[model samples]
Target: MRQGGIVGPFPSARERLGNGAISQSANDWEHRYRRTVIMSDTVATALVVGGIGNFFGARDAANWHEKWGILAFCTELLVLGALAVSRSWAPAVLGQGADEFRRLGRALFTATVVLALGGIALTSRNIKLWIFVAIPAIALVTMTARYLLRLRLHRQRKAGQCLRPVLAAGSPATVRDLINRTRKFPHLGWRVDAVCTTDGLGLDEDQLDGVPVVGRLADVAGHVRRDGYRVVAVTSDPYWSPHRLQRLAWNLEGSDAEMIVAPVLMEVAGPRLHVDAVLGIPLLRVSMPTFTGGRRAIKGVVDWMGAAILLLLFAPLMVSVALLVLMDSRGGAFYRQRRVGKKGREFTILKFRTMAAGAHGARGELAGRNEGAGLLFKLRRDPRVTRVGAVLRRYSIDELPQLFNVLTGSMSLVGPRPPLPEESAAYGPDIRRRLLVKPGLTGLWQISGRSDLPWEEAVRLDLRYVEDWSLALDAVILWKTLRAVLHGQGAY
Candidate 1:
């Protein structure tokens, strides 16, 4: 039982999700994502300790041996289930933006909350504060610190530059955008060595931003084989029909070069994506997002448990923060505003007051100077920030008050970033998909360069996470969010 739980029942690593054609390495963010192992072992060890205690008291249940055995078996299943769910969540979100990462974290937190709440509900015993506090604390500490290490790995990848090199294949325009996006994200770990058009290169062969156009689509396999290119990125180029693509796949087979297709869907995620092998033809299918049955139950449990634990541990700090906020500014210490949440529900989102009392009313004053991209309003160096507020915002201490939001069922420990009404208002119907899950205090957007991201990319990241919700992904995001907090990147 113990062994199986530690090793969650899931497909081995290779059967895992593919990295797509993104050439960025996550060396900088690997430590945080990798730390899930440490947490799993920690959880496993805790269970083992519990079992040992039960063993000594075996005489109490000696007359009913199966009762003890059944309990142990259930515990094992819970742990294993947790471990497997988290696996999909973790890697999928590693080093990217918030959406995938937050979904993963929320999933895990949801599971833990469900387990704790159900245990309390079924048994008339009081909820154990120590267990609630200790388990999550250990997991978060290990998980968060591990996230810090991942950032270092990202830095290392950029330093040694030992990234997998790729040859981009597509139409000139699509290839151009793909190459640009890859260059923008250095940590994605892929180095574009060359570009290949379906026909002979029409684009600047002299330089596609320094790398030359090596050959046409006809030469892709041979060029990759000879140049030792590791990946073949297929963009949404019209020239490559299904017949041509199948042939390319056939030719690229049995080679080390991985063939990747970049689906054109904006903001669509893994769960929304389905591949149906029908009548020998594999068709890609996508489904709408749903949060019913086990999903909602899991989320509710997570919100309560995560909030309770946070409130208990940070009660002292919360007071001190309130006092500081009162002294620092002439406004309420805790700021609450309506934001869009899961399924278009409006809830009061909480934040540490970083602006003056009339910050909301004074929106017109800052409109002309708005520097934030898309619908989100931001300025790299905003003048609205008070001296005390700047400090609070820098370390994200101001957001601590959201523990209440999490507790009150208005938010989650991790999920797509909650968007302000104004931001949501500006969102195209497609972008509003971010509202599929509850907003989080810290998320993929917050951690993955925060305000530095373009508005479109941020929206895309959020939707991706909603579709690929998993426990492991959330753990990975939680870890990364910690590092982003420490570094204070893109934080105003």
Candidate 2:
């Protein structure tokens, strides 16, 4: 079936899109279904929470004696509806989506603000502020429920359900890179079965990782028309002039397929994007990294505060682990190892001993069995681990003692993981930059597959963290650390 270009409806690519009729219609039902589920979920949560609040207040509700329940129900619906209206939720439906969570949480907060403003307007200022507590609490519960739903959906997506088939359009290398990236993060749920490149360019998608190439740049619309591909990701290239690109963009208009342009700038983080349009000329501005001076001060304060609190809270557990270590083997409960730290300073990083006493004293015995990266000796199932140590290491309980290092300013709550002195000694110049900041109890390395990561990837993640340090980013890394710690997939 032939379809007009730019301003016309989309044609079907594969029969998989359904019976060869692929307008927005094929995607519409799923879209509407998702939005409806999200709306219903939020609306239901608002009603239930509001109803419970109203029910408990009905006893002393002399003001609510005249058909108050109905009024309250309507008021709750009004609040929820208003909050939903303020957000852009059409992109996702059901219990969860990333945007859905962001908006729903914000909307719940807005509802609280609205209630506070409404209370202020009516002079209901006596202990009435307690009503607002339900706002955050209910939002948390609702968002948590949505998170569970997202987890389920992600699992389903991983099993190959509910996905968009994409035609990656770029140079073979870029297309493969994009495919590899998207494949690595399957939560985005895109399945690329086709590839297309710029018209008659030397860059062919034929050799691009076995995905079939349908056509080239100028024939993109025609290719989509014939094959029924609904998404085309165009990598940035110099050949397409501004006008030609705009024409290409215009040509894909009103189709089921969406055009995504991937720019060449890889170092730009998502948070750094800003746009300005002066007389219709748009500018894309990138924010500079904010990891020095004042930001460093805030990071220091958080590191100290977090370490102090964690240490205080875990004192009894730490003591128990110490006793276990002393009972299991010999020597002290704590182990001190020289590690490379900030500015290449050598520090004795602390940990609850998870190895037999003098495990390294027998270093010559295990030198041939060095089961780790080039310099660092790590073993998945090391016989050196004491019985009690296995349990401690499994859940990362052994590292909790390192909080002391953090408190003494010898380490940080979130930064690059400290390297062993031997590991540091073998470093290329670039690897030494991992010592630019104090080491962390948990870091990008710990969160990103921990000991399972390749030496190169470990270095890459550390460098990335150093170049893009922020307190907010630190907080995120800490949060991810909790999840990683609990999962403990790669710790041992």
Candidate 3:
């Protein structure tokens, strides 16, 4: 839901099936789902308000409708207009990034502000109820609808449908990296149909990483037009000077292809990027990372409140798990181990014991069976795991007690995973960057692949989280974590 939105509607038969495919016939063949998505959102807002009113009482619903129908209609349109003004419907944002959700949030806030100003202008005092109910309902329902639609789009992309062919124009290394990354995450909907290099140095092989070399940089415009490529990505290539790139962009005018320049700064997130024009030249500006101040304080408050609430809601489940652990093994129900936390402090991390009382004593004997990375030790079929423990670990039920860690400020609900002391000792400089933030009960590594992730990849994801941390990113991770837990993909 964070990325990808309804591009317009489904393409016509000629665009999809016939020889006159949109790729072949039109240069402006980007997904045009803004109209459909926006219209449906508006309708959804109206329906939700009406449905809420009817749910309260039919007579009341009718009475309210009669009294406020026109005003309500205007309000809905205003919200939609705010979204459009925010460029939430821009083609580039479709099906990509937290910016879409961020813009949606801005639109909702603008709606609220607009309503407040309008009520003052009219000197009305009765609009409070309408504002309180309608705005939230509209935001929730519309966002939910958009999320569901995004899920559908992801399914289609996974099945290789709705993908726009891309012609990668860059050096061989960067081009291969882009292809690999796009292939790895097909939800991005970029299919490297062909590759175009700077000077066609590797054209003798006609391919790099299995993507055919269509042409050189000079031949990009022709290949894009002839082959109907929807994307022409120019990644960090020195050969394409700024003027040369500008000319290429001009050449692509009115064509179906959209030209994108992949800057060298790939690690930065959208929220941190801005464009500044100085004397007619556009420069990409990157903001410094925010790890302190008001936002961090807000994160701390959310972690404490969220942990307390989750503990209350899951009390019954936690008690049941505790009882099961005690009955299944002749040991304490709860386990505590010293783990490193934020600022390299030690904390007693808590969990539901899933092994025998003396399981730690057997570590030396089973060292030969270790299957983990670096200083870590993991065994898929470890002998020490009790019957109840196996079940607990599978869906991560054992980690439930970490809520206390989060509540006590030793952990966060979302951050990098905490490493053991020995593991911390083995860390190189890059890996040590993870210690800058409080470790989390769940994080990118948790939702991604958990124990199945390779050591290098896990460190990379953790560092990525460290660099681009945001509340929206955390929300996305938590949502994905729920799905991962339900599916139990990589849990041991």
Candidate 4:
């Protein structure tokens, strides 16, 4: 097939194949990156374990090796062994999402358990020190190191390095969506260099959103083999039958390309998805979202405890904001609105008043000037906003009072955005999934772009959160919330 007409500034298929430069870059960097991570993990584990041993075994200078040296050596080995067993160093998970940290955490937990068991078997008192202090400290250090490494890798990706060349095969629409997403999130490390549609056609004859449409659906494996594409992304299309997909997989065996099939259930991911082989056929099984269980119980406890701590920490700031609100407008210092919570339960949500006394009454007048998305009613420069209210809203200081709701079990620190009664009432069956868990003080919507996101995008993010909710995801959202608030990009 012709390799011309590739759009954008990216290298075309012919250019890429000419020097075989980009083709080998993925493998080269992946190998180097994996080695770096292994070294980082080893050095970090050794340092933490060695430091702990020295601090505790210093009492017996001459016998320190016999006493703490053996235990420390064993601890280090166990930690490394756990990491290897857990696939924490897997290249596929290195620089994106919560999976890398989650695997590291699992490794640490495994190491801790093994250490405890070994301690019991050997009757050693130092095991408690390792389990209680050393392991936790190691976790902190290693996770921080990994996060730093990810930041560096993200920077490199943004600069157009360390990327895998993707060969996308699907309908034109799906291919276009894939192109847009890869361009939008370059940090994910995918670059769609070529495309293959049903009849070797794209939306624009030869190019689909700047990516060259090189071949027909049947030509996918051929292009992958000839051009050395690193990833073969098979998006949803009628052309790919089970037998065809199996053949494609078979064809991919000798090549380094990883085959990724996009399931129809794209919105649901993370731990909720499992692949089970039944009767020699691989079946994609989706587990139901958990609303009640040990994890939910833990989430509740974390909400209450976190809210209590935040309230205590922000007490003075909250009081000062209340005083400012009272002085700024002819209204009470706090605003109370009935919002829909988990299970469609109604609860009074509180915030430091950021509008005039009768702001709700006047909302009708500004209906045409509405800038909010979907069911939300907002105005970028609403006349009802007091000076103090504007500042509060800009920095998200107005939401401080929601901590009290979290403490009271009416909300969580991380979940879907709580909707008003009218909004909840208007929710269709699918959208109503947001009410399955308690609302959150901050969520995917808050950290993503706040009120600036499009209506569909906002709902998609909220639904994504509900479908892929995990404690690790919650922690990631919370960490990102700080940066989002500081930027104040989408706040009204």
Clashes of each: 36, 8, 12, 0
Q: Estimate each model's TM-score.
A: 0.71, 0.78, 0.89, 0.93
Off by over 4 Å in 4: 1-14, 17-20, 61-66
Query: Model 4, residue 480: what's the lDDT?
Result: 78
Higher-scoring candidate on TM-score, 1 or 4? 4
Which lDDT tens digits does candidate 3 get at residues 300-346? Answer: 99999999999999999999999999889798899999999887898
Using lDDT as the measure, the top candidate is 4
Off by over 4 Å in 1: 1-152, 265-267, 379-384
Give me the runs in candidate 2 sitting further than 4 Å from their true place.
Answer: 1-33, 36-44, 51-114, 126-132, 199-207, 225-228, 236-238, 278-281, 292-316, 338-348, 361-368, 374-376, 404-413, 421-439, 465-483
lDDT of each: 0.66, 0.68, 0.80, 0.87
Off by over 4 Å in 3: 1-36, 55-66, 201-204
Error of 4 at 405 (Å): 0.9
Model 2 C-alpha lDDT per residue in residues 23-95, reported as the tens digit of each score: 3443643464466456656665666656655664443544432233543454466456755685635543342
lDDT (tens digit, per residue) of candidate 4 on 5-79 = 111123446567444445575677787778878999899999998999898753453433337888888899999
For this target, which candidate reaches the highest TM-score against the unseen true structure?
4
C-alpha displacement of 148 in model 4, angstroms?
2.4
Candidates sorted on TM-score, descending: 4, 3, 2, 1
Name the lDDT value of residue 33 in candidate 1: 43
lDDT of 1 at 228: 52
For each candidate in turn, give its C-alpha RMSD to the true structure in angstroms. 8.9, 6.0, 4.2, 4.1
How much is 401 displaced in model 4, in angstroms? 1.8
Stronger candidate by lDDT (1 vs 2): 2
